[model samples]
Target chain A: MRKDRVLNMLDNAEDNIVERLSVPALTDNEKERLLKMSMSKLEGMSMNINAEEEVRGVDVYRRPRWHRFVSVAAAIALVSGAVGTGFLLKRSGKKPEDSFHAVVSPEQTTELTTADTVSTDVTTELATENTVIPGTSETTADYQAIAVDLMKAMNAAELASSGMLNTDANSPLASDSNYFKIVDGNIKGFDFSTMENVRNFLTDNFSGKFYEQHSYFIEGSDPFFKEGPDGLYARYTGRGSIYGWDKYEPEIISSSEDSFVARAEYEIAGTTFQVDMTIVKSEDKWRVDSATSTLSDPDANNTNNSNPYVSLCKSKIEDKWNELTNESDNVSLDFVFNDLDGDGSPEFFLMYGNGEYNYQIDAYTYKDGALKAIGNLPGSHTSFAVDTSSRKLVLIHAHMGAGDYSWYTMENDALKVIKNEEFEYQEWGSNEATSRQDINYLSKGCIYKIGDGTVSYTQPECPINEIPRSNEINSFTLDIVDQLYASAAE
Target chain B: MTGNEYRRLYAESPEKAYAALFKVYCDYVYAIVYNKLNRVAQREDIDECVSDIFADIFFSYKRNGEDYADLKAYIGTIAKRHAINSYRSLKLRSERFSGDSDEEFASFADDTDIETNSDDRETRSILISKINELGEPDSTIILQKYYYDRSSGEIAEMMSMKASAVRMRAARALEKLKKSLAAAGIML
Candidate 1:
């Protein structure tokens, strides 16, 4: 055994003995100092918690009210059977190709007829080749055709309502004073005169089973419709918006006598996903039974072909890597991509460090079609981990016995600190000293030893366990970075 | 404080609750931190650790939504775990700067045998009992001088005595303790 080991054992034994004996008391000054420190920290944490709660409250209540308006507009457009394409184009100030149009203009209707004839010709050719069932082919074709028409109707309704649905400004529905009413500068409730319109809209498009499952327009479940003495009035429930797809091109995946399933490529907000629509024949008319959407492919949405900013950001990071590696052989550069701001576009965190102590994190995000540096944090030892609960990055700056933990969030296209906690060594002194009194008759030859006036020392105070366990970014080879970018581009 | 009392206090006023909690547990937490870190860390480090423990306790109560049935046990557990982590971190850092190998540090962390641990505990118990027999300021002088590694002058200041007197008492106490241990068939 090493001599140090035996000494360590003795030290441990002494500590155990002292603990068993009695606990030492802190001076009143020390107690007061610690209490003050603790209370200050508590206050800071409380502020952070309150801020988070406020943000969540806004997300839950404020944003959903706008979506409710859009839902009502879509229902109204569907029942009225009016294509507001021209109005939508005028309101959005967007060209036809920039937005989605389910129903083409009168000029394009002739072209659509020719395309439909071609589609019929192709089906006939396939049936002649015995690719489809002999007797059920016609019925299958009819179901598929009906499914496509219904999908188009749904899409047209969404497109028509998109123009009139304004969360920030007064909706056009508010102008129809007979059917709607406004209160407190918001579209608060619908007039009782609109009850018949609401009933007809719900009865026309949805099946009984759909109503049972969704309860979307019901009085009790949705809280959107309430019965009063006069009639049914609308209530504004703060349930957030449901997004509508820009386009859905459907193909029949399966067919039966009473029902058909159509899988469609649903595009929305510059991203493409898949949705399965179930159409069933009810009361001699086909209606949408249910539609389930699949998760979008992130790679498909983030590809260089789709987003030019991705490649730009990748190139910028590569240039930085080369510059860093050129400076020192022992330097390391690593990066991880995350959509910290929930804006669909991912921001990259680049960790640059020397082999020993010096480290830094440089955050870059694509803004205005170019890679822009958002923030950089430098320290002797700096690392970042994701706080999954709050969805923020916790940047840790640690050194020997002192460090800072800063919670970072992307706000207004820049990285900002939400909370910061610091721990460091503290030095304190006690001036308590023992005093001796000389007797008046004491001889001059007598001598006495004096006490040390003060005792002081520095001690490390680290709250390692207080930090949340988070997923930390680990460095990999530059080749892996290249591979990541290449795969994303592909 | 009990968990119900704390919750009630927190509901009434969070600031006052935090103050009450700190006042109750500050000394207990400081003792644990100081005991764990005294050999390796400085006074400020211990102070900071104590404050951090209280802060963590308050934060956890507010944010984690855990109904701590035994608040004292909860506080003690947090204090002990945090202090241990701080100790390991400081020790590892000290070893790194002192040019020690990783293997040496690993052994230092893991090499305590059961037999050796039991023997050490028994011997320390006996040593402490015999030292107590030395009585009064002598036992304190000895403990402060040898166990705490304090200087004679500091021990004198603490005991309200002359430095020379503290040193003399510490020496005599050690001699007496050594004789008592020998009579019990134990060697220091």
Candidate 2:
């Protein structure tokens, strides 16, 4: 074939042809530069890959490669003036080591009669720390800016450790630092223990949704600037009557932009409880990252499910329900405390379920210092959700494959059903060629005529004009109904 | 280093393996890329292509695994592909800069002396002289095919001839070259 001739020509081509056509090679300088660059790039990549482990408090000895690389990088950063090494070195009271692992531990609750604020020596030392400052060496007044930064880190660690702020696992207190030491001490004065102090501290310090699985009175736009008492903090105040602390103080254990820790002590009933608080700086202010308190009593712990208040509420509901129903076996009670009517008071949403046969949903609002049942609905399966924005309560009950959505509103101290809709899935068409399923929604509207004490329901073409009907009864489901009602309210 | 040495280096120290590979193959890759791009790309661009070729080699090992039947062949293939890509991009960029449609650019670009700035003076001159002796578009076709390693289809597009005609012309030119080389007492 002709291909054989072409192949023969290609194979017979002299090796000298390629040798003669060779281009110039790169110089030694270029090779060295590229090799160094590649090594640095690999080092950076490894650091990024192991950043999570570093954040989780893994020791340096475990990651020898990372430790070696970080030591070089940190030294380079210091010498190149990328990070201020002056303050970091000055606080250690010792020469800087290659590893930078000389960490200071915060002392236990040992009170010292020192001023609450940092001293002038702190300012002078911080001034030198900020080498990035213009015009070489700066004065005391010039150091004020970075001083605020250092103070914020200190305050963040202190407040976080003292249990005055919210804390989580991501708190900076867990970070290893060499400069500051967090010493724990409890103040047993009424001034520091007052509900006013706690309210001011929480309101001023916390931002956004710090309370998890807990609700607070959020008036207008900002949750921080509420008009009335905060619900989550009320447990520690006279309003909720759960528990109160005489004084809690977080001592800055050690501080840095990278890491911070605090030793906190809380005084309650002549007993001083110790806790380790993690602090981290956020947006120029120090905040509590997390906390570990030493409260062994299960009852004293608010996080405990077996708390007496919850148990009493459970017993009160169960005792009343047993007296009425005479049913006890295979029964369970669950509750959610939330403001259902936007009235700045939490209403207990209680559910009583007996295996798969009976389910009762109830709403109890605290009035006159006692829990009063505002509404009740019973079915095979049911759910209750409140749209606080619209002051609407949604109750969905499904039985025998048919479900009804009943919307209620607070009227004259009682939850009155305003509108109700019953929906069920039905098969449509005859053959497989043209078969479909459709949702048969029977809508109703409540009307109260003048001078009539009773309300009557009338059929409506579309109970909710905006809510599009589908073959799937998504509202019949618990979570979907809650979301739908929330979206409607929004 | 051999394949076994490379594997050991990769296992012990990946950075060291990368450096060793670069040292062993950098010049080979540079030569391949520079020759391919001498006409279309600048010296700086060629240098960048050489660096990119090695970077591609490093990443390929990362992506496809470190196992290779022939490391030299793998590196050579990457170099060839990278050079081809660079040549194409440079050509496209020049065409775009000139603001010419395909037809206009091809016609205008055909007049350009392909080996004007080529290095390897003695070898290029000998090839150019031999190709010139073939006469008219036949010489251009031979140069494009053998020297530049361009395909017949691309030659056809540039010469405004059918791909089949271009292939036929190339085969005849090669036959002519064989006869000419034989006359000059050359074997291949």
Candidate 3:
């Protein structure tokens, strides 16, 4: 009880403490400067709502997305047929090819140049003024670096010390979110007695389960490092009913000479939360040992919890295949393609659909002339497009209500995904509804990588495209996105 | 607090948010934003970030975002995140990561010490001292937040964090900071 009191006091520290830090009013010039920029930004954003039209001759979303290795096509019919062809077609317009690319423009102004100049970054004047001390440029760099290292050390320590961290204590709904470690693996040097027994022990004591073995495929060029052991290990975090809302905290795993802990941060009900974990040296390699956790605010008030509806939705997504039992205005679908090798044939992709009605993405392989379920990924409704780069098999997907689309790279046989970038614009809902609703759909599209410098995708104008307007959206975001991705990928 | 509570505070009590900023910081909001901006960054971005500093403070409090624990820590994270986001948009952008050459500035990922002795305060002190030697807002706040346990929003309200972070600036700032410091022959 005493400990709880102290912790609670700390949680509500602001309520009891006197205010710190002083206030500075915005200067008149500052106010005006801010207003002008806001207006310009708003104007620019509005201009982009219908900006990306498929490059006139360029084709997008015509090939497999998560398989960049597909350089060899049985009939790689170039959307432009040739690079210059697409370029020439779009070049006839007033906008340059640059508009088709998402290159950050030079006209963009910044504050770092408080010295009175425009730039893409904030003005250099602002950057300079923002310095810790008058000339803390060098010092500031050092400052942030130290902070990063410390956090890493702390994170490492937390991993080593507790092995796992729980995101919510009130709801004891556990999973591998807070903790994932090699509870078991087929290490080459060590016998089953040295490690398998320990693994067996964990399997018996905790709610242990085997995870899909994601063997590390480290390249000589990759930056991430992994030490110890052979084969692969499966891990998961545990959840407990300590708090009102479900929280998955890190779980510890004991290894022979070393320890490895794992935790997952997740978006629960629209907020991000994480579990803590640690791993330490065992007699041989590292193995996980323990976990600690903190609860999130969303779990505070439990009477209105919507787990049943949310869970029903989530479970449908996790399943590899499920028939559409019913339908409503909330139905949405997205496609996901995965290529095991750089070569394109026999690749697998799924149709992931979700929304207010019933969310399901039916993935089928075209074997025996009938499409059969292969996989599924559920979050919200999804929108899909493809990117065929020599380096990666990329799929750009936007889950419903997600401000940004995520990038999933199909390397080896696994689908490695990460949130990529965000773009402006939303579509208004125009589907059948017992109740009227506003939609922000941008999925009315397909992407085609026509050539090295040209690509295109279609984004519907939503209500405008469906109602009164007779034509489909004739815009392409690829010109902008391709430019951005090209630069970033480089 | 609820999101509604946060919205209400942001609307009617924007000054309350600003007041919170004042409480957490002395006059650093402008200083932090100034530290990261180029002339190209418009006032709107800075102002939005400034206003958001407060919103993040309150919402983050309600959210209890833990990548950082204290207000100072949160602000520094926010400011850096915003700055980096803005930098990507800048035309004449100089490589911010180019000049950092300290070893203590190295990241923990590069560090071999997986088993940290959390019980040893001396060990923590060595780390803290190494951080102190690094100096600057990043140093001041990263330590106060990550090492000391602070939140990015609290840091924002204090004018310590930059605006424009989708999530807290990649939680790797401390690791990077430590690597730089260590390279400078400072071992905390």
Candidate 4:
């Protein structure tokens, strides 16, 4: 057997064995160096999360809810500026019917207005007493529009709070935007020049318990923001980069004279979620009271059960199990599914052994709804080895201090022999043996005979023989396969 | 750190909590990644993998918002998976540019092998028991020099001894290990 092969096995030994072998303590300087490196990478990930458009190929997940809230709070600090006022006024001026029609498709309009029609009976009666028309299509459209506006305003607040809107140098909030400041290449503080602007922004967009919870505007009440002599300032809270919702599409689900519940669909990190926002009229102005989100697509959240790839694997395993069981009464079959080629698809590895030292393996992958054989290894004196980094499968057969090594790789859905070598070992008297060969493989006509503490290359007396590929599945029972599958899944 | 302490610290200060978490578990994470990728990857790759693992753990904790009863186990699982991914990526890239012929196959073989065997667990257990019997600096020397593949100077720094002394102890320890394994009817 190869010495490196034995060492690799020991590298992945049991947890107790590993712990015993890896006992050298790291110096304090080493720990500090590693910590600094980790912190830098994490900071980079955080920046990518907060970016408006993810860096070209970077993979980012959704930002946590708490960070979004803090971003909105920061945006509120700039409410006194012209950018905030212009955005609010531009949004408020659009007629409810016009805004509703512009924002949603005709099909969505019908669905949302249908829910309003059933719930607006009481509103119709109240409208009849006044000069307003009762149960008119315009009235129903108005109700849906109001709910849509509240959702839009909340989303706008999050965008502005995220610092995406005022990034340009000419923007009005750029120079005086003191709510968040970068120091030493980090966003470290939250300090506003005016507290009244934040209070007004919060009061206009949020109300009731939701507003109370976000009442950092209340002097000396919340620990996050403080009203000191040098404007309203907050200590650095150590939160990562701030991000806003990528998109929000709201449709009124139900409506009444006083309230409307809107379902808003939004996308973050390429995944969609639906948030049900409850909007209520307080002091004659619509405001968002609360909202809760659920994943929009069932399959996106439960891939293991619905994934077609998993189904294909399970089906093929069952077929192979039946075929093996029909051929023999006592057989030992075991298998594992791994993405050996880093292709994001697991390849099936089926092993048939005699419950002793000899074992054979056959690898298969699913393509066009059929199992395609990718690789295989015949039975050997020891189990086959997989080099995860190089994606090579090695088989070694050893007996009487002689061994043959065959290295295989998947090429065009077939295992191709990449390298082959044979070696012989001899021990002299006094238990002395030659140092293991550190040189590269010799030409095909040469063989390595290690002895007397020296490595010498000599022509082989006979031609070297290659190990034959075994692509056919050896018949075996299913009991061991089931256990192996369960273990692999875990 | 206990789950409660981490939660409390996270609430009070996330930066402080991250520092505490890294300080407590960096070595364990480093060892796991280093052992898996040492032969195939460069030192920089190993360092980057360790950092990526911690970043993943921190974000996962933030996203799940659940209290981990066993924080070490959670960290260990993430570390192992990340190391494997790093190893695969590095290996694939190297294969694309490698220019070795059959004459270099033996050296190539020495650099690539990552096999694990449940069948060998019992034998490994016996071998580890023998190594532990060699005692203190000797045991550490053998493991650090052979298993970890650390240089004698590096092992000396960790054990606070001279490099020459570390090499001498390692040689003697290997002899004792061989004799001990022979007594158990095993030969190297």
Complex DockQ per candidate: 0.09, 0.03, 0.02, 0.14
Candidate 4 is scored at a TM of: 0.36
For model 2, what is the error of residue B58's alpha carbon versus the real structure, in angstroms, after optimal superposition?
Answer: 1.4
Q: What is the TM-score of each candidate against the true structure?
A: 0.32, 0.23, 0.21, 0.36
- Per-residue lDDT tens digits for candidate 1, residues A298-346, read 4553434444665665565566555644543333344555566866666
Model 1 interface CAPRI class: incorrect
Query: How well does model 3 score by local distance difference test?
Result: 0.29
Interface RMSD of each: 16.2, 23.8, 16.5, 15.3
- The best candidate in terms of DockQ: 4
Name model 3 segments beyond 4 Å from true. Answer: A1-336, A339-490, B1-39, B42-44, B49-138, B141-188
Q: How would you encode candidate 2's per-residue C-alpha lDDT over A1-490 as one tens digit per residue?
A: 1232231222112224433333223446666765665455445544553353223222221111112112222222222222211111112223222111111101211212122233444455554655432432433233343333333433332322222222111111112211112111112211122335544444444433332101222221222112222112211000010112222233445555433555545433222344454544467654445444443232332332433334444455556445423432223343444455667654555555432222345666767666677755442244443333354455544322223456666655556667655432111111221111122112211111111111111121121211111111101112111222222223
Model 4 Cα lDDT, one tens digit per residue, A38-66: 77776776566424122210101111111
Preferred candidate (TM-score higher): 1 or 4: 4
Clashing pairs in 4: none
Candidate 4 chain A, poorest ten consecutive residues by summed lDDT: A444-453
Candidate 1, B-chain TM: 0.62
Model 3's number of clashes is 196
- How well docked is model 3, in DockQ terms? 0.02
Off by over 4 Å in 1: A1-22, A50-490, B1-24, B61-69, B91-116, B131-145, B150-171, B181-188
Model 2 spans > 4 angstroms off:
A1-16, A19-24, A34-490, B99-188
Report the Cα lDDT for residue A4, model 1.
Answer: 20
Which ranges in model 4 have alpha carbons more than 4 Å from their true place? A1-9, A52-490, B11-15, B62-65, B100-115, B162-164
Per-residue C-alpha lDDT of model 3 across residues A1-490, encoded as one tens digit per residue: 1221111111101100111111232433444454444345444533542232222111112222211111111001121111111111111222211221211112211211121212212223234534343332222322223222222333322121111221111111123211112222211111122234434433322221110010111112210112224322111111001111121222222112223344434322223334344444334322333333322232431322342322222233334223321311111223233333444333334343212112223333333434434433332223433333333323322211112334555343334454344322112111122002222122222222222222122232222112110111122221222221222222
Chain B TM (all candidates): 0.62, 0.54, 0.34, 0.78
